[model samples]
Target chain A: MQHKPIHIIIVDDHPMVIEGLKTLLSDDKRVLIKNQFMNGTDTLTYLEHNSADIVLLDVNLPDINGVEMVPKILNIRANIGVIGLSTYSEPSIINQMIKKGVKGYLLKNVTGEELVNAITQVHQGDFYFGSEVQKILADSVTQESNDQPKLTRREKHILTLIAEGKTTNNIAEELFISPLTVETHRRNLMQKLEVPNAASLIKVAVEKHLI
Target chain B: MQHKPIHIIIVDDHPMVIEGLKTLLSDDKRVLIKNQFMNGTDTLTYLEHNSADIVLLDVNLPDINGVEMVPKILNIRANIGVIGLSTYSEPSIINQMIKKGVKGYLLKNVTGEELVNAITQVHQGDFYFGSEVQKILADSVTQESNDQPKLTRREKHILTLIAEGKTTNNIAEELFISPLTVETHRRNLMQKLEVPNAASLIKVAVEKHLI
Candidate 1:
């Protein structure tokens, strides 16, 4: 019996990582490395006209943020599966990538077998989060959920967008509001939560189950 | 003439990771897996009775913290090389592990070639940090060296201990101070840095090049 190899596009900022991924998948005939890109811009450009079964997208790219890149890739190719990759696994980043529509998430240290398994599962229209990634996400859920203060509906929406890795301009543009208004909402959220920055705000939100 | 293979022990809570590592290195004749342990205690006990050329230890273990495991391993066998492993790459953890005498550090996603190279390099008494780990450490160094207030030498020492993933009790014991004094120092450090937790304190300290 013959099976079509799952086509994969590897996107990472580091040349060695791309090379390593290629080497890891070289012997596996089940998944084919159809193309590779060093940054997000080239990957987006490639996906505009071409398509692949799965995209191994790095979370940190020189050009575009990996979380934001998910939607852009999906906007162009609705059916394509994006599997997030990164050296460090921040629960917020992984959770944000998933909320934004990644079919799978993997740490950069993924074994070849796990890589193939993730690609195969994602290509079959299922989710595949690597074991470590699963543990991180699970840990996030088990954190002591605290009783929290309430926010206005608009503020909550903005907080979600913020947690989703949106820039002020991106959120404003998406919500059809002014950037200044978005900034004000952000400030209010911080003040209400008593956090210093967006990262901490998201951390608090995750802890409070507010977002 | 054939050289003797390096004896290696695998320590990770994940059984799959150990199996995958074995499979990855199965074809390579230069190294040998002498034994494997799913927790740090057994690995430590094994080290007491027997020593291997290298120990591939996971950063997270069910029984012990990975970063703290370094000094303990070296205490038992000063000549044996210890290579730190983790699913995600945390710069502080990597830096702390290096400070405590880990010859090499690798993310779990290491390929057979890189893993073997790291082991062989460390076995030869050289340092080997995976490319991604190297990038992360580099980023940590390049963080803005902030112009900040000065800390007393004692405060700085406690800060270093904290960044090395030490607990209040551990710091107190090591520094010959009461745990309450350690708590006071930690609180003062947090107040000076205007951060709420040890993690954030470390982040600011890293950014300021204070640690």
Candidate 2:
């Protein structure tokens, strides 16, 4: 059956990565390289005037975070598929990206065939994941089903600020809350995460993707 | 003239990355893939029994940090070349890897040619850096020559604790110092980093690689 070539856009900050992807996927006859961008801003700008069937988006970009960019990209083109690509297999990041509605997740080391398959799958409205990504997803699912702590929106906000090294006073000033309230939230976060100290609290929060 | 092929080991947690690297470098006649491992412990264990000319070490690993693993790997084989490979171009990580005696640093997106060239250069006892890594190094140097804060060891420890969201009391308890002493050090760190709040202090310190 004859079909239109799937248009794909590559967005990553590293020139070498972009070049490598181009070289790796050039031989695939079923896909057309629509464009390449180095940052989220440029990707968004290109998407405003153009359309693609799939986007291979790096999880970390020089401008905007790839996960944060997913929903924004979707808002611009509701049907375009987004694939999260990164070197990290952190369950937290992978889970977050999936939650943000990426159609697939791939590691940077995916084979040319795997890349093609991922794009093809996503183009056909199926989700794909690299082997390691799949493992992370499976593990995260198991963990979430077990004892994942549910955090309030305010607590999540405070936790992120804390991860950024905000003091209680600074968080209070920024959130327009009392320092005591921030401290209470901090303690509540620690208790909920079951961490003994601030360092362990931050570490656990990061591991659990609470922040 | 035919020369002996360089033996190389790949250490990264991602099975696909290892597979991809094996596939990418398989055709290079001048280099031989001696071994591949998924974590630092296995890499170290392999090094304990065997040796390689170069180790393409990922900065982030599942078991131990790649940077921390560098000296341990070198300890096993002092003459072996260590090349830091990662998705990050963060100056702090790059600078730390280089300082720890890695002969090269390459981003995960490096072209096959660049990867081979980096291995060859490192094998020949020369330092090589990906273009983006070079730019980060250059910018960090410029920034350091300007107003980069000089922090003492104790202060650096305190800064790390603070970034972990530790309060003065928490830090004092952990470090066995008085709360007033911890507060003084915290104030000094903020002053030295020229940040108005703890958040900005950590942000600047991280940007400057002070911690």
Candidate 3:
């Protein structure tokens, strides 16, 4: 018995990219190109009547960008899986697409087999992350946000207490550290940041993603 | 006729936050608290059988950070709506969560009425963003990625042509610039970047996000 083919819509501005994808995906029996669009507006227009199992969306569309289009597509149909295809590796774009409910994240230069696998996995209700995509996700998770003090575990605990409006002496006594050490941390932070005061240093720490 | 109440889950380590959310949401007849988890791992466990229509997710989860857990929750159920609730306003984290398929992005200081509105909007398949969240999204779109060169539109067009192996004479002709001006730009770039050669300059420029 044969299974139903995976219907897909390709949305991109470049004719060469669409042509290339058609050529690459033509040989797969499980896949069928339902429609192709040159821009986000066209894709949305097509979605008014037609819905595909998966969508190959380019983030840098000429009209509406891929990140902006994710929500619009989901609004049309929540289950229509999107696989983002882009050349740039910016974390912001990647994160935006992911939050917009994209099931597969891949670079434009993805191997044919990987592309096929990603579509299949997403179709089967599993996420597909290319190696670089995974690295970007991990980096986002591990990297400290720009605001907040870059604190070690102990330092973080100290910061929490500080943010809670605790005094250095009280914090030091509570955390079993010397008041001199607390003063030392304060001094070190000021020196490293070249700030004049603790309040200003905290502001800097919050602004720089140092936390 | 009445609709089924929205099932909700609250994930945060802070007892105060849980109590506050409960207090805020309890009076609303449309919302029903399904479960509350202290961390990402517990939230993951609860999702095994119990499904929630909305989840109030905190970025600073005790076991796994919310940025990491956003994917995990989406992986569990692509349709479940997640609203990020955190004290942190770091663009990176907010952007990361948005990419991970959150339906609403709100700060921890959100009022009860606002939270209810967000949850209702998300449940009805609409995106929601607080004023600050909207500002963050707008700022993120404008904020240049550190990896890419921050070139003016003309410079980027020129650089793109150069990256495509265009000669200075060819680029000058295409961009309608004098050869002397091209040389001037080349020299200025070298001086500002402290690169020895054009090839090195292009490489460094691309690397530094300076187009």
Which candidate tops DockQ?
2
Taking the tens digit of each residue's C-alpha lDDT, what string does model 1 give over B17-68? Answer: 6666777777899999999998889989989999899999888887898878
Q: Output the lDDT of residue A135, model 2.
A: 82
TM-score of 2: 0.61
Evaluated on chain B only, what are the TM-scores of all the candidate structures, in order?
A: 0.74, 0.82, 0.68
Order the candidate numbers by DockQ, best to worst. Answer: 2, 1, 3
Candidate 1 local lDDT, A116-156, one digit each (tens): 89999999999999999999888877972233668999999
Residues A90-138, model 3: lDDT tens digits? 6656876787789989876566678789999999999998897888778
TM-score, chain A only, candidate 1, equals 0.72
Using lDDT, rank the candidates from best to worst: 2, 1, 3
- Candidate 2, residue B114: Cα displacement in angstroms equals 2.3
**Higher-DockQ candidate of 2 and 3:** 2
Best by TM-score: 2
Error of 1 at B175 (Å): 24
| C-alpha RMSD of each candidate structure in angstroms | 9.8, 7.5, 22.8
Q: What is every candidate's C-alpha DockQ against the true complex, given to 2 decimals? A: 0.07, 0.16, 0.01
User: Model 3: residues >4 Å from true position, as ranges?
Assistant: A146-211, B1-211
Interface RMSD of each: 10.3, 7.0, 24.4
For model 3 the local lDDT of residue A46 reads 89
